[model samples]
Each structure stands twice: as C-alpha cells, then as structure tokens.
Target: MKTFKSNVELVFNNLNSEKPSRNTIGILAIKERFETALPRSIPLNGYSLESHQKNEYSRWLKINTVATKFKNYKAVYISLKHPDRAPGDITAAEMRFVANIADHYSGGLVRTSHTQNLLLPLVHNSNLVSLWRELSSTNLSAANIDTMQDIICCPGFEFCSLANTTSIPIAHEIQNLFTDPDELQALGNIQIKISGCMNACGHHHIGHIGILGVDKKGEEWFQITLGGRADEKLQLGKRLGPAVDRASITSTVEVIIRHYLSERIDQQEHFLTTLDRIGIDSFKEAVYG
Candidate 1:
C-alpha cells in the first residue's frame, strides 16, 4: 500500500516493478490497498468517480476486471435521479464506488469523451453482481443503445482555451427542445456534434451535423458541415460556403434539417445520406435561402 506523491509515479513504479515477485503483480497491490481503505455503498444514480486528467493509468489486471463487468450489465443508465431536470448527475454513494474503483484500479485515471460522458476504461470478466453493483451504484448501468439519445457537443466557452460563444447551452437547448422520446427513437442513429472553434475539439469531424464556429474578420460566425464519420468507413465533412452569425446558428441548423426532410429520397435517408446525394452545395443554397 505504498502511496506515491503523484499517481503517474505509482503507474511507472508498477510497470517497472521495483519488487521482484510484485513485478507480475504490478499495480494490483495499489488497488487492493485502495479497496481496503474505502467504504462501500450502493449508488443512488450512475455517476463515474474517475477523473480523466492524466492523473494515472490503470494496471492490466484492473482494466480487465472493469471491462468484463461492463459487458454483463443488463442496461447502462445514462442519467441519474436528480432534483432538477438535469438528467445525468448521480448520488454520492454511487460517486464513492466510482472513485474508489477508479482510484485504486487505475490510479484514478478517467477519460471523458467529446460527448461529456465518462469512460471507466477497463472492466474485467468477473461476477456480474460486482459489475452491476459498481454501475448500479452510479446509475450508469443500463443496456439500451437503440433508442438512446447519443448527442455529441463541445464545451463552447466552458473550460476551453478558445471559444467565442457557449455551445453547451445550445446542446442542452436542443435536448430539452426535443420533447418526444419516440421522435428521437424514430430518428434512429443521428449524431449531432458541436464545436466552439474550428479546431473541432468536440469531434464535429465525425458527426452527422457538424457545427464549427468561425471568426468572420472579427465577428463570430459558424460553418456547417455534412457527411463526416470516423467509423470503419471514415470520411471528412464538406463545409458549406460562408458562415452564419451567432444568432442564426440554431435556425440554420434546423433549416438544414428541413432541407434534408423535404428532399430526402425516402424515410430511410439519414442526414448524412441525404447530404451525400444532394451535396453540401445544394444544402448551402437551400439553407441560406
């Protein structure tokens, strides 16, 4: 149970192995120590305790455990029970499970995706209950992706080194604006990615509707991109000509969708396919009109 001043030091020590027998054991020693030191509780809502700021890396053994547990969950809960409408904040009890496991197993290494979701990195092949207990504690243990609202967005002004306007608020606006769960489900596999800058930190490069903010001489503007992905079939989005002012972003996005709906060959045409067939130029003309 040796505590290093920095988690990175802990990781390096485990990997390098100062002790002979512990060489194979690696960071498992740290994890075992951490587990003993922490108290256990059932999570009220699924929230991740792992913080992803390069604090530490997980040992192979712990990663295996976490990964294994993930596959066994019946369902992963995306949101937690909160007093307000904000959906994903889990309770403190759940927070402890995430923190203890994340800290001990991975040296508290956590990674947040562009979508504002946290990843536990590795889970192992073990009893489903421990996995369920870990996830259930945080309210993150859910098993449905078919109808889930997988929205991708950037921070905009929040914590970003560069940003002119707020992008998070807009994302929340769209999420709240879309009232019908069935409508979202029917849309089926739509990816909405927003960015505060042209650097595309929010992974606008891979979203169906990629929103990028541009500096028009001095005023803030936005560029629209269509048909992009990073799947096995990776492709970059084509930008429509010219950028829109800050106030026009929401309407412009909706207008682009309207164009897609009006010109789509069929209900089966997704936003990207529709963009491909019509092309970005056509969409630009239609949207700007």
Candidate 2:
C-alpha cells in the first residue's frame, strides 16, 4: 500500500515530469494521490459532515470525500477586499504568511474566488475558532462574505490604460460608508460591482447595482444600472439615467438605496424584486428628480 507521503511524492514526480504522458492521465494521477492521501469512510451522498455544512458551500460539490470532508479536518474561507489595490495590496511577506497558514492548517491547499478573495478550503474544524483569531491578527478572514461589503471591483485608471476612472478609491468609499454591521445587515444582500470601463472586467453588468465608469470630454462620469443579477435568476440591469459625475457616485447610490428602502413592500423584499415589481421608472424619477 502506498503511504500518504509516497502518494504525494508520486503526484509531484508525475507533475514535474519533463514529458507528461497525457492530460487525463496526469489529472487522474493527481486525483488518485488526493484520494489516497485522504480516504473517506462514509459515502459522500446523504452523509453530511457537520463542518462541511454551510450556506456558503452549498453551490460547491456536496461530496463527503476525504478532500471535501472537514469535520475531522475542516475548511474555512477568508476574503481580502480590494485585492488589487491599496490596503488590499498583498506583500511578499503576507503571501508567505498565507502559504504558511495553508501548510499549518489547511494541508497546503489554497483557492481563489472570482471575487478575488483567497480561500482556505480545508482547515481543521477544531482549529477554526483559533484559526480565525490567528487570521484576524494578519487581517485575513471572510468578514465580508455574503454581505454588501463583498464588493467586486475592477482595476480602473490606476493600472488599466482602458479605464476612465479610479475604481479602487470609489470602492473604498462605498465600503467605508456602511461600516455599521447592524445597518449593513438591515440592507440585506446587496451586490455593488464597479467597472473602470465598459469592458466590464469587474462584472458590473451583472451586479445588482452596477457602476460603469465612462469618460465624457476627458472627465470621469459614471453610469448606474439597476436590478442586474449574476445568480440563478440571471438578468442584465437597466440603465438608471444619464451618467453622473464622479463626485455624485456615492450620493447617487445613497439615493437609490433610500428609494428602495422607502418603497419596498416589506423588509424581506429584495432590491431587485422590488424594482421588478414596481418598474424602473420610479427609480429613474428618484435619481433624476
């Protein structure tokens, strides 16, 4: 029987091979190594591991394999906001720290999300509480997951030549505005995505409230879109009105949110659903008027 150490060695050897046999073979070899290194006793189907059970992990494969089962060795997610700029900037030391965390807690595996956050998907459940404390010390934790704070932003004028405005600062401003956790919770699951240009690398087209930066006569102007979604019920948001100056971006968002709050039938009604029911005309009036 191949020991876990030997299995890992074999996997690495195959990966490092100068002339790999075939892609499928390489994949199978790696999968075999993972399976051998972490064997599951119970069938993944209908056998739910307490640690693996979370609303966040629902969309991911629900298999209780050795790799997926975290009760004995749990996993956790950590989000780094504005991962591309400023405070979001990760230094080499921080990268090493993250690597160390994965090695010490999550068996040397790290995952990145489309939202640009790093995920430690296999940390031991026993170490979760302490792990959070450890991660918090290094400013690493999924603090903004499933909340409006988990903003998706693109590289704007700061780095991208195609960008018309600086998205990171705007994103920071929006995130800072809702510092009160309780108030943020009351706001519900709102998604605010920003794109530096019409390229939509930030996926602003699919955000519930999308902001696209446009250049008007060499000045930065932003166009707002309402009711867009990237979820199961995917739909493109409609344009609110004419572009607003960069200075009015935050205030414009505030106005839209205020309108949604005042007119929503109930607290449970989501912004998109409310907009769908009432139509975008009223939101347009609120923004323009």
Candidate 3:
C-alpha cells in the first residue's frame, strides 16, 4: 500500500442497503478491497500443528490440498529457508528443480509470497508426501511456514543499496535461537518480518513482531513493532518502545516471545491473541524493563 495508491476497493459481497458496513478495511480491503482470497497472515481457523500430530503427510495436507479448488489443489507454502542459503535464496539448479516439481505436481502453477516462500497452488493432496520428499532432498522442506523460523527478511545492506543496516544476519541469528522444530511449533502461528530500510520491502510494518533496520552515527540500529497484521483484519503494528543496538535485537525478540509464552492462557492462544487480550503495554514492560 505504500508504493501503490489504492487502485482497488474491497467489500463484502452480501452487504446491502438494509444491513451495511462502511468499514473499508480488513477482509473488505483485501487485494483492491475484496475478500476473495486470504493473505498469509490469515490461515485456516483453529489450524495448528498438534491437530496433525506426528504425521508429516497430514501436516502437509493442511498446507496443501487434494484436487478441489482450482485445477488440482493448493499448497500453502514451500519454505525457502535452508542451512546453506539465506531465506528465499534459490540457486539456478534449485530453480530448475522447483520448476520440475511444479510441472509434475502442480500443473505448472506456483506462487511466491511476500514472506519469501513459494506456494504450489495446484498440488494434489495425494502427491503431498511425494512432493515434500523431493523438496526435502534439496533441504527446502522445513515445514516451518508461519512459525518463528519462517522469517521474512529483505536483502539488507548485503544486497540492497538502500538498506541502512544488514537484515539477513539478524534473521539468521533469530532463526538460530529456535533451532528446535518442536520449540518453534510450540510458539504457534506468528510472523517476524524484517526490513533493511524504510522502503518497507520486507513488510516489517505489519508483522506480528516487526524489525526495522536503521543507521545512527554510522552504527546499525533496529526498531521493533508489535501487533501488526496484513490479514482479513488489517492493522498497522504499534512501535514497541524504541530502537535497540544490533547486537541486542535478537535477544530482545526472544524476550518478547518468552513474555508471550509466559502470559498466554495456553498453547492454543496465539502470540497475537495473548498480546491482544492483555495489551501491548505488558510486552513493552517485559522488553523495556
């Protein structure tokens, strides 16, 4: 929305003169402003890893789908995060490899996301396991989509000329903190978007937890935001307090996460829900204190 002025308008289809809503936001403002499809921030309601249990295929089923919606189905996300590469960094061979997977499994259809992951919107559910195995062979099957490890970061000073500070390294540092899959899943659905500069390429502005890179006296600093969303109920995240030095940013994020874990009613209550229920002040105290 920053780069593009409102080119479209969205509203509920059933709304009428008798029963009307003037709120031109949230689901009504999806895309140009219609609620046809949901953004990544809004996943299937009541969806969680526990429901799928230990069955990898079952989990993938939730991420993907059987022949239904479109030509075949939809695969929510195929993580690009790997130990050997930065997030979304796909090599030539990997590109060809994913292309082949799409050709074979998705009717030659795929979609990339703002979060820097790929979605095969036409994969058959029956082929979920097969596709996952193929992607796993190349280390693309992290199954950590929308989890803490599924970080969305822009190419910072390392790549982008407009960047004030490096973003990939900080993303890596945060990723390293939660190397355990179980621990990440325990945290539940959350988003951590980082942008290298004010261009807002990485969408840190609306992340469940946002990290924005800045430069101060030639030193790198980061400001954080809480409770932002780009989903059906769109909201601009509030500034948590102030910027922190680069070295401490990752640890500060951990502190916020720990605070959410401690205060949540249960694992079922997501980070945002907990933050919403109690208030952002609670988190500000936990981090600033």
Q: What would the per-residue lDDT of candidate 2 be over residues 1-289, giving only the tens digit for each residue?
A: 5698887776678777876646648677787777534322222234333563343233222211124453476545566663334434567987899898877676777877787767777655455555555665776653566456678888798889999988988888887777664566677878889999989988898989999999999999999998889889999988999999989998888888889889999889998888989889999999898
lDDT digits (tens) for residues 1-43 of candidate 3: 9434433333334244344455534335565654434112222
Off by over 4 Å in 3: 1-54, 63-72
Model 1 per-residue lDDT tens digits across residues 33-81: 7752222233334533355411211221222122223343222122331
Over the full model, what C-alpha lDDT does candidate 3 score relative to the true structure? Answer: 0.78
The runs of at least 3 residues in candidate 1 whose Cα sits more than 4 Å from the true structure, single-residue gaps closed, are: 1-94, 97-114, 118-149
Runs in model 2 lying further than 4 Å from the true structure? 1-75, 82-88
What is the TM-score of each predicted model, taking all chains together? 0.56, 0.74, 0.78
Question: Considering TM-score, where higher is better, how would the candidates rank from best to worst?
Answer: 3, 2, 1
Which lDDT value does model 1 have at 269? 74
Q: Judging by lDDT against the true structure, name the best candidate.
A: 3
lDDT of 2 at 27: 79
